[model samples]
Target chain A: MINRIRHILLLYLRETSFVLLFWVLVLGVLFAHFLFTDLDFHQWLVRYITTTQYPVFSIWSSVMLGAGIWITCLLGWMFKVQYAHPRSSLLPHYRSSHLMVGWICYLLIVIGAIWVIHVGGSFYQDTSDKQFAFFVAAVFFSAFNLILGYISWPTFAVVLWGMLCLFSNYEYFILTQILGEFLTNVFVLILTSSALLLLTWRLFHLKEEHWEYPYLFSWTRTSQRQHDALLTTLLDMVEKRLPSHQKHKPLKILRWDVLRFSIYKTILFFSAIILPFYLLYIKALSEYFLSFYQSPFKYFLLCAYSVIVIFGFHLRSISLWGRELLFPMERKRFIKEKGMNLLIQIYLLWLFLFILIILLPYMLLMPEFLMTAKFWSEILLTACFPLAGFGALTSLRDLSPRQSAFAFLGIVTITIFQMMQIKNLDVPILLMESFAWLFIGVLLIKMSYHKWCQTEF
Target chain B: MKNDIIDVKNVTKCFGSKKVLDDLSFQVGQGSVFGLLGKNGSGKTTLIKSILGLVRPQHGNITTLGDDPWCFQESTKEKIGYVPQMDSLYPWLRIKEMVEYTASFYSRWNSNLVNELIEDWGLNPQDRIGTLSVGESQKVSIILSLGHEPELLVFDEPVASLDPFARRQFLKTLIEIITRRPCTIFFSTHITSDLERITDHVALLHQGKIMFCGELDELKTRGNLNLEEIFLEMTR
Candidate 1:
């Protein structure tokens, strides 16, 4: 039994090695900071726990939430592969054993998290008081719900949970005074957690046979293929609904590019509609929270979102490169057309961002506050970094790991600079920085175009 | 020969330290069904891709239809049709939609031929490609390739996933196309029976080089055995 449990643990670790490596790198950086600076591990924990200020509280909480969600999704993926397969039919008893092992593994993770909190609290007992305890309990319960929800119905869980998150009043809910009197009691936490666990076990026992989960973990090799199958099915459905506009589009490549662009634009339209509502909801939560929103963190998120969308578009292009190139068009013409199409997409996205994030909010809710030049400059600055990234689409194949790291570092430095400039609000300096980025962006785009023209495939 | 549809001159290709194709050369005369036979991982797809200009060889040169395949012009591309070993048709698009998308690239598109193939193959124009079975998808791929009615057709293990009935139907279609027009066909496959039925000329690839390049009848006479036996013996 011990050997089997050990083997399962090893398998889980191997499967989640990428996420684990990310955590390791983050912890390593923290450790290095502690080594060089005056503040120790205990000091940092105290600061994190006690500092309920704007950026620190928001950044730490968001990072922790993101990490928890990522881990839950990965666990959901593993559970599907392990308990929900044809092989489980042959070895029925294995299901019970697997369930037992899975419970033990999960308990081990929870215990590990508790141990860290306990160690951190040992240095300063006040840090582990009611608020911190409630935070820990919330993390555990939410993780359980997320993983189970994801395992049961992926698209439903993702979309519904994502929508629910938009309406959440973080400041209103996380008031230490309000939460301290509520379900922050240790006894209540234990009872509720046990009940949820029991319910999960019963559900698993009853529907083990009929459990069908979508493969959402596209980073993993096996799951990537399954996810692709699911994507194709969804794409097929979407393709039927979209009009081809084939009459005006005489060129074949143009029609193809236009179809892809339409799909992308449609998604952006939905997001644009959702964004203003979400921002309004957040605004109503608290004026303090609104100030938190204006921080460099929002721009960082913008940059990240742009990178993700562009990366997805690039993946589609590269995957179809072979098939598309077989057509009669010159390689240069093909790439040039695709690049131009992508540029239109980027501009449309930027326009939507400007309208939804800037213009709409100012016109409707907070007219005078959002009209500041600093806010406008920050938005423009956000566009510059991602636009630079867009240029590297053609040169992505040639980008070495070192160059990528340097580029990431450069973005991080710019974000830090933007954070500092938030208080100062110097228009000349901001515009100068933006133009520098724009110049670099244009240069990279030209270089990539030249490189792509010379490339054989 | 100057009139040859595809001419290869000592093509060599390598990936890192491993050589996939080594000093290979062959020529296919116009209006001939040339079959390429090789064992699994014997660089059959690589060689086909090289001929199509999808892949570059480390050494030597290849000319298709009197132009270098590496820089094939639009005019040259218009004359070529290819069915890859793996069907890469967009699963998002329907048979009719995919056909339309592909047809737009060429000046001459035979919509009648596409519609006929779709109907004969028992595929609906409205059916999503993702919902289709492997054999059904392969049929769609074949239909898409043949829609433009190119002068030269290059197929890489095109019948691998096809059912026996579909395979026979495909061969019949191929025969019909050739009989209707003067065309050159180059195909690679492991199935010797299919090759024996259609191909006039044959090339045996072994260890990244052509072991035999001559008439199928001549090879059969020399070996005093069937095509399959000859293939198995040569490859073994």
Candidate 2:
């Protein structure tokens, strides 16, 4: 049994070396921060338990929790791959015992991390400080396990949200309030830990997970063919609503726009639905954001801009051009019309995003603050660069989508840096930047047009 | 004897250092069931793709339907159908929807023929293409190609994914289409029995070269062996 366990451990290490490396990096940074900082680490721990806001601690804990989630997902995927297969499910490889062992392995790692933190701090800390550290670690670990359980069994998340709604004030359920109970009495800690362990055990023993196999197959496998399937599904959903089967022949150019715009439209729809709820969540946790900024609207602008720009880079997929190559169309007309179609989609997306940016300030209850002429100029100047840069990159036949994405990111970073270097928001500077962007965009577009005309499949 | 539907002359296609097709030459006669036999990586797919203008040969000339395939006119395209080896169908569309979408591209589409084939093949038109099995998706792809009723049909290993029963049914449909119209079929497959059943002429491609290009009966009579035996002897 010991040798078997070791073999499985080694197998997991070999398969999931990247996740393990990330875990080690997180712990290493935390230790370095704790050891190298001038502040007393023990006092920081005490303050973290007592205070509501500790930005540095919060960031570290979030990183730690994120690493925990990453490790959990990787381990779960390893087990799921074998069990998801039809014939492999009948084999002896993935058993309930193996699942429990995997979870226990994860649990031991978290416990070891807490132990190291405690041992490293014992030079100047006392027993009370020890208990505080233990309670905080318990809360973090419990949150991690609960989240995993909630994901494994989605009904639990619904019940959890319902329970949260029943409370009159969210203050009653904040992390410090939960920790206060843990620090004041030992019984609460024991009961909560037992309940978390019981939940984890139940989650690990779930046998009827065949329903999730299809989703797992697509999510875990990132092949070009699967990517094409995803694009096809998105495009078909949009195409179905259009009058595809009208009496007269459908406009091929309009159909082409539908294909190009499907991804952006779906993303924009989801963003519209989620952004409001996200703002409300930020409102509920206003104390956290209040320390960094007076209003969440600025963050919203940043997020919205980043989302639109990030999606712009993803619009041109590698395998997508292959789908249209076999169609019987004049090559020159196809190229010229494709350029027109792309420009139209880019303009439409720009219009929709501008309206979204305008509406977001109103939604966050800061309508007047962001309506200045300078803000408008800034938005206009920056908005088209991402789409233009990415669209021009799409026309280049040599770069793969991944390489193009990296290039887009590099260009975006340089442009942002240049904009940031400008101290004054003068009209002349804004106009110059906008015109420069236009010149570069048009130049790249022209170059790509010629390249595309000469390209063979 | 018959006017050639597809003509290839000294086609040489190279992928970097590897030569996939070397100075290949062959002619597919009009209204004939032509079968191309080759081993794995023997450039059968490359040759078919060249004929359909999906691939450009480095040094050669290919003409299909009396026009350069590289720059086939819209009218020429309307009269040609191609079924690629892998079915790259829109998984989100239903079989009926896929047929309609493909039909929109061609000027001439036979809806009655499409419906008849779908029904005869025991396929549900409402079923989503993604959820269908590999053989079912292949059937839909075959149906999509046949819907336009093209004068020339180019198939690259069309029966690779189909089961034996579906393959037999597909060959039967091919025979029916041949009897029903003056259509030309050019296909490549590994299944010798299926080829022997349907093909009138055969071409053996080995090491990017054609070893035989003639009537199946002539080759069989010369070798005094079955089609599979002849293929092994020639390729070996």
> For model 1, how does the per-residue alpha-carbon lDDT over B17-94 read when each residue is reduced to its tens digit?
889999999999999999999999999999987887766798999998998865566677778888878754556566
Candidate 2 docking band: incorrect
Query: How many residue pairs of model 2 clash at the backbone?
Result: 0
Every candidate's DockQ is 0.01, 0.01
* Candidate 2 segments exceeding 4 Å error: A1-83, A93-277, A290-317, A332-362, A395-397, A415-428, B1-236
**Which regions of candidate 1 fall more than 4 Å away from where they truly are?**
A16-32, A49-65, A81-84, A91-94, A97-141, A148-284, A316-319, A344-365, A396-413, B1-236
RMSD of each: 21.1, 21.4
Candidate no. 2 TM-score: 0.43
lDDT of 2 by residue, A151-264 (tens): 332222222222222221222124333344434436555665676566455434332232443343332233334544665576566656677464221235545444443344
Question: Chain A of model 1, TM-score against the native?
Answer: 0.68
Give me the displacement of residue A68 in model 2, in angstroms. 7.1
